[model samples]
Target: MTDNTQHTAQHWVATDYGDLDVLRLEETDVPAPAEGEVTIDVRAAGMNPADYKHIARSGDRDALPVAIGYEVAGVISALGPNTQIASGAGAVGDEVLAFRVAGGYASSITVPARDVFAKPAGLSFPEAANLLLAGTTASEMLHVTGVARGDTVLVHGASGAVGVSLLQQARLIGARVIGTAGEKSVDTVRRFDGIPVAYGEGLQDRVRDLAPEGIAAALDCVGTDEAVDVSLALVEDRDRIVTIAAFDRAEQEGIRVIGGAMPASATYRDGVRAHLIRLAGDGDLVVPMAGTYPLADALQALELLTSGHPGGKLALLP
Candidate 1:
């Protein structure tokens, strides 16, 4: 920040709203953080499907060339006057992680200090960068569904990032989880202590075979009708079923849907950041990373993400 004009950064942006082909790796001036903000020298950027989803959905020319990526783990390169991070005071050279940030797919990012947090020593940069978004989402699903100790919950797409988080967090809450995964992902579900049931035509019967005691709630991380139909059939209490993606299905079926885009969900997710990060620090929660790619290979990473079998979370090492 000593010489504001001298700082520059390489970042990913969607010059137009479309597919991955429209994205460009471009250089831009790194602005000095304004009051209550700080600039970070990013070490890693977390990858999520949401990152690419935004790029193709803006549908507005004015919002063209929007920055991509939402979270990062990095070092504080500069601090604004009187800036304080989400956890407390921040300092230059402090290792940190930030969520709800723009342009995180970069070598550096300047973001609001309010979104920055002290990175846990137990988490590597890749893990720290990938924690908050999915972790918070999973936490909210469990919270809204009234998942409690001794409760058995069914999670669709159990091997996904959010599902993995749900399994770990639910374990901490003393709730037993029955998770649905592909044959290849069965071990991953089991690794997280979830009863792994292979998902397909016989998913419901398979789930019933594992949890004959009855499922107390259902979490739909996958948007398939099978997820919705099975959840509706198993959990008579519609209030106990929730989906993060199937908005229309939720409306039709009267099941709940939660995401960062919803006001209540956003508030809850933000409020839980401190607690979730602490859990990661204490090793009560583990972020399973399937892969990491160079910053410039964000598209390739996105391709794997789009493949719907990433195995776990993905991160971009900058």
Candidate 2:
């Protein structure tokens, strides 16, 4: 067994507030898990636009050296006394996935065990790592909008990570999804049982044509002027429309907007993690894999993530 007391890990950090150039990889000591914590030898780290977005928008100079990445899947290397995983009891060597943790873009990480749950055996490390972040976001979006069986949801940016998860999750609950995507992602939309609608010119009219009875809710994953305009035009009930993006438009237009940074959103997302884990483990929900990148190539992976055509979920293999 590897010595648990000593671990030298390579992790990525942003030394300043800027773009990818601010990201610097440096070797650091992995401290042993403290009270109510666990140390993980990370096999895979989930990548999202938020990973880079947070860094790019960092105006706080004091928080300059914040670590990157939010979720990871790996084996527990060490655990604090009297601590238990969120799913229940756990031990060193147990395979687990953690979300909403910091510094996950590393070969190893020590995080509060409360947020960690056992990785489903059916899922690969990367898939498990990719599961909760987007799943929970999709869940929150649907929850806020009160999406239910037989209801129709209008999803903007249905081909992306959150979008794909939204499509599948909505499908599982018997809600029909009319998803907006580029011409290339029509198959991606259909594969997840979503009705594909191409974005751009005539988007509003096309969505109207697809759901003439009217959209039950509009979930905006991509914050585009077009999405906001179309959603406003189609959905009569303002409170039923929500956005994870389009924060400014949501404010100006009096629509709902939620993000991980918000306390209420964080609480809701955390509360639903176990459910999402169960869904993925039971094979009811499948996270579409876009691709993986080496730990050293975080920038490249993030570049693809920001490209707006990631195809599906992306991960960093540590």
Candidate 3:
């Protein structure tokens, strides 16, 4: 087992919901696990677009001083009493990954055993850190859309983490995949075995030419109005179209949406988490992390995220 005390820990706290300037790096007390929980000495943390969106736009300043990260990959440090995680697959010192209910920006976090998963043997800490939120969201979309053999799937923002994941998972289900991205990311979408199409102006023509017969289902990982418009144009049924972004607008457009902070039921989250673990272990999933920033430089990481077009997921290493 590694010596847990020899390491120093740091956390990023956002004093108020604003820009990257709002985040502060501070030396905080290390966390301890409660029963049914395990404390992880965080090695890496993954950033999502929602992290910045929530900080800038969510307007609920009541949760000020909130830690700002959602996914982490680390080593098991301490475990709470009566926790199976302490004795099961992950004992003290085992490498692990977890999706936080909150507080993942810290150098250490206490996560419920159910929300933690054993990191796959060949995956690095940074790679595993990129999986949780985007991977699970993609899994859920596939399930909800009932994508099946011979179906033609269309994914918007195919160069992004969720879009790439959707492309791969849809392929695994025996579906033909076509994805939209900027012209520069066309190669990346093609690398994922998806037919690549450009995402602006003439998007409808590009998608129609690629799918030919029809697109059985569509997933919008990018919330652009163009993405929504193209999906509605190609798919005959609005129910078969889903958006991870544009939740408020999806309702108005009559398209199905998922994963906004709108009180998602526990059952749904559990099912999605299960699918993620299965796909990761079976070699059916891939999470591309665009870049990494030192934990102390979280502000820079947020800056990169806010700049947009990261090309993939962004992460922080402690």
TM-score of each: 0.97, 0.97, 0.92
Candidate 3's residue-wise lDDT over 275-315, tens digit each? 67667777878777688888888877777777778778878
Q: Is candidate 2 or candidate 3 better by TM-score?
A: 2
Ranking by lDDT: 1, 2, 3
lDDT of candidate 3 at residue 134, scale 0 to 100: 82
The per-model lDDT (C-alpha) reads 0.92, 0.91, 0.79
lDDT of 3: 0.79
Q: What tens-digit string does per-residue lDDT give for candidate 2 at 121-228?
A: 999999999998899999999999999999988999998889989998999889999999888999999999999999989998898888887899999999998999
Q: Which segments of model 1 are wrong by more than 4 Å? A: 1-6
Q: Model 1: which ten-residue window has the lowest total lDDT?
A: 1-10
TM-score of 2: 0.97
Q: What are the clashing pairs of model 3?
A: none
